[model samples]
Target: MLILGCMVLIAGCGCLGLWFAYRIRRRPQELRECSMALALLDTEIVWGATPLPEAFGILKERTDVPWQGFFGELKERLSQGESAGIAWKETMIAQNSHFCLKSEDWNVIGDVGKGLGRSDRTEQHKQIELVQRQLMVIKEQAETWSGKQAKMWSYLGFLGGIAGVLILI
Candidate 1:
């Protein structure tokens, strides 16, 4: 019974590690998806010269949750007559919990809104491109760090649990 209990504890610890690792693994994909959404926004801006709300509406359809939610919120805000920049910031703050992004990532995203209605087409394109690049950088960072640490986290959890069981024994 003691041995069985130890094994169960160890398994639980290992599962915790795996869960952490799995969350880490998903971060890169989330950033990549954000990058894609930005790209879609850029396309709408450059080719269609689409208005901010309509561009975000298009993105809301092309993206997944959290992203779709973010864009949808922006569209809703715009429809309500909020300024584009203000809507962007408000939606970002409101939907922040839904993303895996860090504070730095949020700052980068905030920068994307700085030139919304104030900028020329060329400048808007540049801002979108810049944000897209930043997102790609974050995605690369997540992929690199996860590649190194995810297995380590899993192994450490398994080993730490085993050690704990041994100490108890």
Candidate 2:
């Protein structure tokens, strides 16, 4: 009976550990997907030189996911700028979308930023500030969630170990 109980406990613990790991794995992918989608949206907004009437619609169609509130804020900020193209680029950079950059991509964006006309300078600065604020928020949220997840897993492991020891005795 004791052995059976221990086995069950161990199985439960293993399942829990797996579940947590899966969640941890999933989060990074979600972050990446969200980042990539945002990057793409930035590019499109700049290229279009127009505030998308259906920004959410564009995001949903491109990423096949619901628009998040943060993205909404970003869209609003971008739309407020005088020049959409410059606003888009600056916003993207300030948001630390650069973190998602590959070497080739970074180089390309660098070129684009340099080539942007002087008329868009003011809007560009505003975009940078807006994006940076958003990125900081995202980073904090990700860190907090990760810490919570780690603590939860550690507690589960300890409980599982105790159960195993009890069964052995």
Candidate 3:
């Protein structure tokens, strides 16, 4: 029973470690996805000449979770007569907890929200492109950190579990 208990404890610790590593690993990918999604939005607004709410509808169809949900909610809000900036801000706030991005990334995203529906297509595209550039820079940083730390976190988690079990024993 003691050995079994130790095994369970070790497994739990290892899982916790893996979870940390998973979050670290997910950050860059999520940021990349965000950048891509923005590109799509730029195309929709700038070239396709779609309205904000319709652009969001198109975007939600093409995106994955978090972004998909975000765009969908934006569409709904806009359809319900919410203002563009307000809808974007509220949707971002509601969906931020679901993303793996850092504060810097969130701030960049917020910049995009600020320009939505408040300007012409050219200006909106410029804002989105700026945010995309910022997101890429941040994504590069996140990738670098993820590469350096993800494995360390995973190994540390398992090792830390073993250490805990040994200490307890």
Off by over 4 Å in 1: none
Best by lDDT: 3
Residue pairs with backbone atoms closer than 3 Å in model 1 (clashes): none
The total number of steric clashes, by the backbone 3 Å criterion, in model 2 comes to 1
lDDT of 3: 0.90
Can you give the lDDT of residue 21 in candidate 3? 92
Candidate 2 segments whose C-alpha is farther than 4 A from its true place: 50-53, 64-169
- Candidate 1: Cα lDDT at 157: 89
lDDT of 1 by residue, 1-169 (tens): 9989998999999999998788777778878888888888888988889998899899999999779999999999999999888988998899998887678878988988888877888899999899988888888888999887888988988998999998998
**Model 1, C-alpha of 64: deviation from truth (Å):** 1.8
Q: Least accurate stretch of 10 residues (summed lDDT) in model 3?
A: 99-108
Output the TM-score of candidate 2.
0.44
> Please, what's the RMSD in Å of model 1?
1.9
Q: Assess the local accuracy of residue 108 in candidate 3 as a C-alpha lDDT between 0 and 100.
A: 82
lDDT preference between candidates 1 and 2, better one: 1
Task: Write the residue-wise lDDT of candidate 2 on 37-153 in tens digits.
Answer: 545545555655534435534665566322243345445655565344454455555544324323333333343333333435445444434444454455456657766775677
Could you give candidate 3's per-residue lDDT for residues 95-157 as a string of tens digits?
A: 889987777778888899898888999999899999999998999999999998899989998
